[model samples]
Target: MPHLVILYTANLNFPTEEGGDMSGLCRALADTMIAQRDETDKPVFPVGGVRVLAYPAAHFAVADGSGDFGFIYLQLRMGRGRSEWVQQRVGAALVASAKECLAVLLTRQAVGVTLQIDVGAEVFDGKLGNLHPLFK
Candidate 1:
């Protein structure tokens, strides 16, 4: 099965244009998050191979507000075992990653982009796998 992760911090004042610039603070936060992932054992994936994004649409299904500028990271992963409850586990891990210090990266003014960044690491389960979409 395919797994997804959505890590986000809300109410950030990011720019609206495609060329919009993220505040220095948010940039720093992203850098730090990457570093943390590189050192962490949770996802058990390397930083370079991971996908990180902001202005989410896939995993961070926002119910309220518009143009929210929260940061998000999605990482599709594998367990090498059985796991039907992966959704809950992925959701929990994302929520845990989005809390506190990094949350400060967002501002109330940047409500143009969804306060959701998507990071992904599509995994395969004895199948063709999500990686094919990118490599093929």
Candidate 2:
């Protein structure tokens, strides 16, 4: 299972101007993960297991205080047992996808984007959902 969470500054875009399309960004990220493949060209991640969510920070402070500064932090959580290569592939793909999604915002303002991947403890993690139907 893989879950992607994106947290971004609220000022990244004008509130009245659609606010940078978080939903579309999430979709792009999830799609990128679902499309990853291994050396043999087999799918690396389960398409049904991808989930993406985005949150806007209501209050925050940037180093310059120009209000033109923005940040997008991505946290990816997944079950353990994947190789380092796989993780790198997924991370790289996600960062590229995120950049494309936020291209306009980045060009208009100073933005910092970061991505982190967390391997969840198998003993503590639990899942009870069915998204296989969509993948089928």
Best by lDDT: 2
True-structure lDDT of candidate 2: 0.83
Query: lDDT (CA) for every model shown?
Result: 0.40, 0.83
Clashing pairs in 2: none
Best by TM-score: 2
**What digit string (tens of lDDT, one per residue) describes model 1 on residues 1-100?**
2233434445444445422343433443344444432223443333333444334344454446455544445454434432434334444444454443
In model 1, what lDDT does residue 20 have?
32
Q: Would you give me the overall lDDT of model 1?
A: 0.40
User: Which regions of candidate 1 fall more than 4 Å away from where they truly are?
Assistant: 1-11, 14-43, 55-82, 85-87, 105-136
Taking all chains together, the TM-score of candidate 1 against the true structure is 0.30
Angstrom error at residue 85, model 2: 0.8
Task: Compute the lDDT of residue 85 as modeled in candidate 2.
Answer: 90
